[model samples]
Target chain A: MSDTSRTPTEVDDAALIERARREPEAFAEVFRRHAPEIQRYVTRRLGADPAEDVVADTFLAAFRQRERYDLSRSSARPWLYGIATNLIARHKRIEVHQLRVLERTGTDPVSDPFTERSDERLSARSVRQRLAAALASLPAGHRDALLLVAWGGLSYQEAAQALGVRIGTVRSRVNRARNKMRKELGGVDPTSSISEVHVRG
Target chain B: MDEMTQLDRLRSEIPTPELSGAAERRLLAEIATSSQPRPARRQRRRVNLGLGLASGLAAAVTMGVVITNGDSGDPGQTPTVQPYSMAAVTLQRAADNTSKQEELHPKPGQFLVFESQTMDPVDSNNENGHSRFLSRSKRTVWLPVDGSSLDGVLFMEVLPPKPYPGWPLPPEAKQEVGTRGPDRLADFDQRAEYLRTDYAYLSSLPTDTAGMRKHLYLELEPGARADYEAWDRVGSMLAEGYLPAAQRAALFRAAATIPGVETVKKSEDAAGREGVAVAMVSTEAGERQEYIFDLKTYQYLGQRTVVVDADKAEAPVGSVLTATALLKVSVADSAPVVNGG
Candidate 1:
């Protein structure tokens, strides 16, 4: 093993990648490191159960393409984030379907859709309602770029990778998504709207 | 309206998802069985290696072979691998009026697929050419090409080789393990061959836990084996004509015109294949580029771009462009001959 004490962050990523390269099992180390963040990310976009599958799928995809991982960069967060974004994007129809289902059934896995909790649920529900309407009304490119960067925590660059578009293009999509959301929510910007939505919940 | 707050609020609202315990177990099991196949003498060697690594000293070694789910196999049971699914918010093209699907599948392939946006490594107005990244996470179907199971699956995540001190500048990690061509490519092939031989020996070992342990080490270090299974795809593309040689200079010139192109140079591959190695700064627009051309035939071997840094860059972080002849260009049966009208 290379000297850990002297190993740099990039070197550590290389070692993890090399380990992942040789033994698909070695990818588990990378999963362990990033799974929590990934899990949280998925849970936010999708509920707990769906999040689980998405997280697993993200790592599996990363493991399969571990060799393609650019060693020039160390952190796997952006790459993983990119993968998760794509995974989530694929389920857009299901997401809308799920929101509608929740609207009707009032139950999602993470939170009690039935319980009219006055905490975050109200805001989440309002957000869910707005999100569903906003999402459906959104241009696919704009919505995808915005959601990937916003929920996936991917930087503009990383979001661009996930979307396979120029950074300038990503910026535009994000701007459009936000502007649309703002207009729909009475121009209450996604940021403060979220806080108010949560506060009243 | 600050970018960070907007991004943070969005992140908080839409959380990442999770996986079922059963699926996780199955995936791990699949990886274990496929990547690590055991034999005897090498098994003994692996026991020693495992002991050395685990304890850092060779002491009492009570090696245990724990086959988690290997017992219930009917050999022909064909494990019920999970299926992949997707839902896209189709977009309408103004010119055609036909809805264009965006960010549908993450990685589009034969079995499972995850179609995503085309990654732009370098922001050139080059239509139909984007540095898009593909990963298996979006989809879950195993590839059926050439008897490749999840076990023999080889993925190449482009990583810059080890750096020289303060590399990668501020915001980005230095590119390590830079591009490989001809000589180094040859060297890599040799190494793969050596690992294959080692694997052969390990596989030949008697069915014991110790032997299996040895096989694990041999299979785990992807670099130990010189004959890369995946690169053969790159080589085969070279042998074919998908990437014409004359267009390489044009491709590079096109790449150079990209907004963030940097560090262009002529270099030899690990296997002695002649090509150019470029170091590019991270930009939402800058895309990594690679081109391999046969010096003798002047035929384009392979061209690939990979996303080097995703944080300050885009998702494909790196990418590649294979020869054109090898491409299985598909067109709709009733589609227009020119523009698929």
Candidate 2:
């Protein structure tokens, strides 16, 4: 094993990208450092069937454009993500359908959908479905901003950099996405409350 | 639980993806060969020179036999997905419409609002093992446009349509969405609904169809794996993302260059909005996806897809698999937010 401290994980990503430009082989460090997380990220969106392809394409595209990489940015997360998002756009239909199904059934066909809990309210299931439908209902741009922060783990500035948009766009999109989902997260449907359900029970 | 807390709970519930030894090794090896277009010459020199310093270090890096997905067996080449193209007239009209759009720049603190709908097919087991039907939901969004602000553009919201289903949201949390499901940003975490790029980037796109087609085609080169299917990407770039009028027009015109172009006289977007459609079919996938434009102005209305040959795919022959309607895009004073939405 090589020195852990000097491993690609320890080196700055921008430097690694630069090194790969010369050695070509050095790009492996980038794949090593990020592919797992990138896979998880894509799997969540497109399911396991296509996640691997997405990851491979993302890294390959990054490799092809390695020369254009902004060496000023130390982290490759945002840039990698930007490419991934554009790619995901190709699957918007599949994605929207999956999101809606997840919302309606309270389960994801891709990842582990929801924890099985017998005691949860049926209303809660509807709430989950509603939240998903709400997300599916959103414009692509807004959904991208909201998810980047919530799932992709990027900050507002980082997301903005990744999307090539101003920071406020991210902020507003998140806000808009949340607003649509806010109504669905309530534990019970507005038409019926715990007490109303109790009345029915 | 309060809404915000519930959202927080759901966000934390996402399972860590399963790991794959093969996938990891493939990624590293793929990157190794992908560094440059031509690797034979430099690879030889670098391997020898670098071998002296790193010696076993590079070999120790886990060289493996796995092939990267990009290297071969492209799913796009599958027979079902077919050759895609768009009508030249429709492309020219879309390009013309793009050229005529009013250039927009939001003042600081302004919000960009997007209104749209999402539709998809739902199938159930109750009806003789198949109950396939499409469902539709409407949405509205408010946003803060880009510009200098004391705090920054932080506010936006998605509102249910009028005569909303009469729902009461969580009072504790300001706002929440996709608290449970496939994350919209699950890919990399950079989020922005701002599809309309600034003037500079918009101006930089190739303004001619031939040039735009060449630029996009090169993206799938090296392998030269497929045919006009790359045109699907060019058309997608025009309809799905941000592009200025001139650029959008150029893209539509470029789309005209694609082979197998077709036009549907009458079609409906998700919102049940009727319009003419310019589209392409994937013979391999037994499906067709299209971009809808107003019959007269060629204004971009929405996008749609249908199952052309149901026998090859899972759904019925005429089922609308996916549909989206972009209702409005405009500048606003502020976005819908926490207490206000």
A-chain TM-score of every model: 0.75, 0.82
Question: What would the per-residue lDDT of candidate 1 be over residues A120-153, giving only the tens digit for each residue?
Answer: 4424344444444555577667766776677655
DockQ scores for all predicted structures: 0.12, 0.11
Superposed by TM-score, candidate 1 places the C-alpha of residue B116 at a distance from the truth, in angstroms, of: 36
**Residue B33's C-alpha lDDT in candidate 1?**
27
Residue runs of model 1 more than 4 Å from their true location after superposition: A1-11, A100-116, A121-128, A187-201, B1-27, B35-341
Q: What is the C-alpha RMSD of each candidate to the true structure, in Å?
A: 23.5, 22.8
Residue lDDT tens for model 1, B133-241: 1110010112221212221111212232211111222212223113221110000111222122122222233343333223333434444121122222122222211
Best-performing candidate as measured by TM-score: 2
TM-score attained by chain A of model 1: 0.75
lDDT, model 1:
0.36
User: Per-residue lDDT for A63 in model 2?
Assistant: 72
CAPRI accuracy category, model 2: incorrect
TM-score of 1: 0.39
